[model samples]
Target: MLLLKFFGANVDWTSSIHPSAKIEYPWNLKIGPLSSLGEKSWIYAMAPITIGEKTCIGKEAYLITGSHNISSNNFELITRPINIGDCCWLTTGVTILPGVEIGNYSVIAANSTVTKSVDSWSVMGGNPAKFIKKREIKNA
Candidate 1:
């Protein structure tokens, strides 16, 4: 954790990042308080990846912030930021692509590939993840 801070990662001290989690471009990553990045999660922070407070990124989840523009003659690399809002849950093996903004309290199911933004309180699943339902918390 000290090493990550030394590398300019803006992670809150209260956040829990597993030892095996792989983070590239640590300077571009920001994890808020009480967030937990599970073991073996890979964060490709080519641009910026922000995980809000109380969020949980499950084991083996992939947060990728870059892609190649195949149409370009040089096969140019395109980078975009990924934002996961507060109290969200990204389950195991989930892949969050570039430029995605997951709203507060949303839940991304295991093995889902999210290609676009998700609304607040949404429950998304499947490849190219679709909205399965809205998450309802009784006391929230």
Candidate 2:
């Protein structure tokens, strides 16, 4: 999709993104080699969203990198980067909040909401997602 790159997303030529995916502030987005953003996935990136090589973001997943200050009376906006390392998979309907780093080979299960950083090879699922187990890849 040369057209997609024109919109300011720094995606590798090998990467595949669905046409319906919404990437906000595309200049702040980067998807590495062979990574794919599935249909209707939304990346509301006011800051950077760096997706490492071979990552897969499943359908309807949301990666939000901006929020407003609740503690401040003025309610100023705040932005933070989201870093997803290589070979990670964020499954359908998963929501990753701002400032979260998902380590390499991690798997976020369907409908999970991640509020914190995930360790490498972790398998997490649930609201405010916690580590359920380690991801095991049996080279098939």
Candidate 3:
């Protein structure tokens, strides 16, 4: 079981978590059981990021839960929470922006940037992360 020693969050490792994973400034980062974060992944949760159970975060992925609103008069910084559902697979170099919620069992391709919510069982990719296709998986 992997334990995150820093930040104000608590992780229950009855689930599976890699020992070499890193979460910077995790004030309120919560990860469920049976989830695994690959090597060299960066979770920068300036706000809040909740990852569901059995989820697999690929190697070298970046989860940036901080942003700024350019339309504001003072160019104010805006922050939102990120929620990743269960059994999802995020490939390498995937970037999850603030306020994005990826549904359960979804697959995100490598080098994709998620700027919005993705439906369940959907396969997404590209710069803004459009829907590539939908996948139906049978229970094991």
Candidate 4:
């Protein structure tokens, strides 16, 4: 993060960004308020990655922005967008593949491979990641 500090990247408190984290194009990796990115996390950005307010990305989590073309016999590669909505928490070792959009107030369990879109207010786990349950908030 010395590069970010050197480049004058804006990081707000109530948020923790590890020193070992690698963010490709820190300018493009737009983080809203109260968000945190963990240590050794790699966020590869060809397309933009937008993390909404109060979100947390766990340690060593890989967010791949690039993908491959299935129709092409030569197996051409492509890039897909990733958008993580507000108040979400992504646990350690979670791999959020290309073109995945996770909605608000959701939690992805550790070591889960998210190949599909997860709905809002849901809890997901396992390989290829199925929905475990939904999150219910209590009104005060």
Candidate 5:
């Protein structure tokens, strides 16, 4: 992952990124200290993707920062930033869509698809992820 920094990715040296994780547009990617990207995860950073400190993205998670605008006759590509805040956990198979801001300390359940911004400390699940509960960090 150190090589990613050479390509303009703002990856912290303390971060643990699995070798199998695929990252596109490295220049647009930023990973904070002690964060992790699990094995086989894919990050399509057509815009910017910011993963905050101590966050964990589980295996096979997919983060997409671009999509086609079907409403346009030419099907133009639209790009947006994905911001995942501190201490968050995105479980296995979670799919985070474009322009979504997952707030600090949030938890995204397995296989959830987040289509919009999530509140801080929220536990969200299901497709187009809905708020299931608040994350209570003991002794935090």
Candidate 6:
């Protein structure tokens, strides 16, 4: 994305970003090498969102980095970073809330909502995205 590059988003040319995907505040978005963003995916990067190398985000998935301050009377903004480490796969319709980190080589199932940090090499699923199992990688 030439526009993103111009605005200081560290997106590599090797990565694929769907034209329909919406990126807010591109300056805070960093997509590492070989990452692919699916159609209609949204990243609200009021704070930084770093997506590491070789990762894939599915269609309509949401990565949110901003929230309303619960303690504030006026509902002020609270921002936090989201980190998706290398070689991860986020299935379709997944929603990652603020301050969530998906560790390296993790896989998140379809339509899951991630509310907390996921461990490295994990396979997680369900509404609150429980850790299902550790990922097994074969060296062949």
- Model 5 reaches what TM-score against the true structure? 0.97
Per-residue error at 73 for model 5, in Å? 1.2
Off by over 4 Å in 6: none
Question: Tens digits of per-residue lDDT for model 1 on 5-90?
Answer: 99999999999999999999999999999999999999999998999999999999999999999998999999999999999999
Report how far off residue 67 is in candidate 2 (Å): 0.4
TM-score of each: 0.98, 0.96, 0.87, 0.85, 0.97, 0.96
* Global CA lDDT computed for model 6: 0.97
Model 2 global lDDT (CA atoms, 0 to 1): 0.95
In every candidate, how many clashes are there? 0, 0, 0, 1, 0, 0
Off by over 4 Å in 2: none
Q: Please write out the lDDT profile of model 5 over residues 1-140, one tens digit for every residue.
A: 87999899999999999999999999999999999999999999999999999999999999999999999999999999999999999999999999999999999999999999999999999997999999897895
Candidate 2, residue 19: how far the Cα is off, in Å: 0.8
Model 1 misplaced stretches (Cα beyond 4 Å): none
TM-score of 2: 0.96
Candidate maximizing lDDT: 1
Task: Report residue 66 deviation for candidate 6 (angstroms).
Answer: 0.4
Question: Which parts of model 4 are misplaced by more than 4 Å?
Answer: 1-14, 70-74, 138-140
**What would the per-residue lDDT of candidate 4 be over residues 61-131, giving only the tens digit for each residue?**
98888878889999987988889999999999899998899999999999998999999999999999999
Tens-digit lDDT string for candidate 3 (1-140): 33363546655565555566678776678888888788788888888889999899998888888777788888887888889999999998899998999999999999999999999999999998999899788799
Write one digit per residue (lDDT tens) for candidate 6, span 23-130: 999999999999999999999999999999999999999999999988989999999999999999999999999999999999999999999999999999999999
Poorest 10 consecutive residues by lDDT, candidate 4 = 5-14
lDDT, residue 67, candidate 2: 96
Report, for every candidate in turn, its global Cα lDDT versus the true structure: 0.98, 0.95, 0.84, 0.84, 0.97, 0.97
User: In angstroms, how far off is 121's CA in candidate 4?
Assistant: 0.3
By TM-score, how accurate is candidate 4?
0.85
Worst 10 residues of 5 by lDDT: 131-140
